[model samples]
Target: MVQMIFLFAILALMTIVLMEANTVSARDCLSGTFGGPCWAWSGEKCRRLCIEERHVSGHCSGGMKCWCEGC
Candidate 1:
């Protein structure tokens, strides 16, 4: 039982470390465009954009350009 618990704890720690090391890549806002905005919630990542004029929210890494419409 103790060994099982220790194994679970180690597994949990490894999972956390893996998650923290993971990073999401930027998405394309406009077609033919290479870089755009990217959003990451938990371990998943997504690409989002705003039509017309609206406020958009997203997350990106360093040296990445974050684009949004409106204010």
Candidate 2:
């Protein structure tokens, strides 16, 4: 009986944690990347575009792409 209770508690905690991780109002995990060096723009410029598009985080990737996080 005690072992069953402990397992149930663990499972409940895991469910709550996963729910928090996949929040609906804000994307806590979803992310993507896009290649750059197009239109005579630098990677930094492309990163700003990602930010403008509402990414939670954005960065220039190795002078060739824009990497962004959040949705």
Candidate 3:
């Protein structure tokens, strides 16, 4: 019973955290393929583009994909 209560409390805390996170800002994610140099499509580059587009952050992923994130 004690363990169950603790688990429930942890779950509740996690739920609250997630909810607060969503309330902070909603992000719009855009992903696209690039054929340029790897450095040209780096995570920092994508992040900068996102920032220019008034976004929060961004990253370059596998398969030469650039993920731009905005709020």
Best candidate according to TM-score: 3
Alpha carbon deviation, residue 13, candidate 3 (Å): 36
Better of 2 and 3 by lDDT: 3
Task: Give the number of the best model, judged by lDDT.
Answer: 3
The candidate, 1 or 3, that scores higher on TM-score is 3
The alpha-carbon deviation from the true structure for residue 14 of candidate 1, after best TM-score superposition, in angstroms, is 0.1
Query: Candidate 3: misplaced stretches above 4 Å?
Result: 1-28, 31-41
Please provide TM-scores, in order, for all candidate models, with all chains considered together: 0.33, 0.35, 0.41
lDDT of each residue in 1-71, candidate 1, tens digit only? 99999999999988866664343334323212224443333112222433222334333433243433233
lDDT of 2: 0.53
TM-score-based ranking: 3, 2, 1
Report the lDDT of model 1 for residue 56. 48
Which residue pairs in candidate 2 have backbone atoms (N, alpha carbon, C) closer than 3 angstroms, thus clashing? Answer: none
How many Å off is the CA of 64 in candidate 1? 22
| Candidate 3 to native Cα RMSD, angstroms | 8.6
Per-residue alpha-carbon lDDT of model 3 for 4-62, expressed as tens digits?
99999999988866664453233545544323643433767777776776666766544
* Residue 15 C-alpha lDDT in model 2: 85
Candidate 2 structure quality by residue, lDDT tens digits, 1-71? 99999999999988876664443343332224344342334545655666777876554433233555566
When summed lDDT is taken over every stretch of 10 residues in candidate 1, the lowest stretch is: 38-47
Which residue pairs show collisions in model 1? none
